[model samples]
Target: MRKLASICLVFLIYFACSVMSAEDRTIYQFTVKDSDGADVSLEKYRGKVVLIVNVASACGLTDSNYKQLKELLDTYHERGLEIAAFPCNQFGGQEPGCDADIKNFIADKYKFDPDLYSKINVNGADAAPLYQFLKKEQGGTLIDAIKWNFTKFLVNREGRVVERFAPTTAPKDIVKYIEKLL
Candidate 1:
């Protein structure tokens, strides 16, 4: 009876550990809204290296970030780099516009092609589930909530969280990490 009990306890512990591992492996299994309010499953990006950025149209770093992000996309797109940009007004109300207006402004002002990004919320109670999971995977300095606009998270092709960049980290600076993963 003592040996049987010990085996059962070992089995239980192993089962619990397996469950935790599975949860960690599927951290990217979430459904978030697209810019048009449509459900977007993160699983579609399972085998692609994704750079998730919280963007804002009116932020101080908007122009430079946009330009550099475009350059990054052009540089690494065929090599499996995907940039997912989420527009958020949570920081100083920088992205205060309706979906169409935001889209239009991104196209007209920055000459950013809509086909190159995904826009959504980065911080708030209504923040997308993907962002929520990302923050939990990589909490920022002094807080879990995103501090401001243009904060970036890097995910490898396997959907594992690789690195998290603050709002100030330029898109160009992220290339080395991307190259290493590729």
Candidate 2:
């Protein structure tokens, strides 16, 4: 029937363009908002090895992850390493604070000085475009959706995503990959 044909066509179009193709796409192509709501382009990190992670303030892994991440930064930040931590509240509502509060918590608890980004959804229909691209490029064990907070995506100096780490994988565990990229 004509109505059935129209529905199928609409479905096909939507499926094809849900997200941009992961191939030939670099993280530098996107612009994201920092904690202060200022637009920051990933392009500035073009020649640096970058670790992008979704963080939650109240998660069980918060302490270890932030400590290890800060360590990694202190060790390799001068050697061309950059960490982009995105505060996400999708997992169990862990990061239930405003940008200022999140910034204050990290600074006071862990002495983390890097720029904190605005809270973002790492999964579901409202996922950020950068996240959508990262998930498509390096899919998970059973699904492309992000499993939980602290999911890390490592990008090479060329701005392409090279590795995807789970929420459970500590930042210290991937120093070799970062060193290699650097």
Candidate 3:
């Protein structure tokens, strides 16, 4: 009876641990809305190095981040680098426009087109599920809450969040990491 109880305890422990891992949260497990409000499954990006960024059109960092992000995409797209830009207005209400306005702003002003997702709250109670998972996987420098626009998360081809970058981290600075993963 003692041995049977011990085995049962061990099994319970293993099961608990597995459950605590959010069922192995992978990027492929999420489906998010795009700029057009269409359901897009992240599974489509499986096997590609993905850079997930919480973006804003009116942020101070917008200009440089957009330009450099475009450069990175132009350079490594064929090599399996995919940038998933999620517009969020959680910081200072920087991204206040509707989806179409945001898209047109980026393309016309920055001369760059991105895989734009629907505007989402990247922090607080109403945070998107994908952002919640990302914060859980890699809480940033001081807090899990994203500090500002352009906070980036790097996910490898295996759908694992490998690194988190602060909003201030330039897109160019992340090239080496992307190259290594690719």
CA lDDT of each prediction against the hidden true structure: 0.80, 0.91, 0.92
What are the clashing pairs of model 1? Answer: none
Q: Alpha-carbon error at 10 in model 2, in Å?
A: 16
Residue pairs that clash (backbone atoms under 3 angstroms), model 2: none
Q: Per lDDT, what order, best first?
A: 3, 2, 1
How large is the C-alpha RMSD of every model relative to the true structure?
5.6, 4.6, 4.9
Per-residue lDDT tens digits of candidate 2, residues 1-182?
99999999999999876665755589888999999899999888989999999998999999999999999999999999999999999989999999989999999999997657899998889999999989987889889899988899999998888899998998889999999998
The order by descending TM-score is 3, 2, 1
For all predicted structures, in order, the TM-scores are 0.81, 0.87, 0.88
Q: Against the true structure, whose lDDT is highest? A: 3
lDDT of 1 by residue, 95-120 (tens): 88877777788779877763333456
Task: Give the lowest summed-lDDT range of ten residues in model 2.
Answer: 16-25
- Segments in model 3 whose C-alpha atoms lie over 4 Å from true places: 1-23
Largest TM-score belongs to which candidate? 3
Question: Which 10 residues in a row give candidate 3 its minimum summed lDDT?
Answer: 16-25
**Model 3, span 1-182: residue lDDT tens:** 99999999999999976786643678998999999999999998989999999999988999999999999999999999999999998888899999999999989998887789999998899999999999989997767898889999999988999999998899999999999999
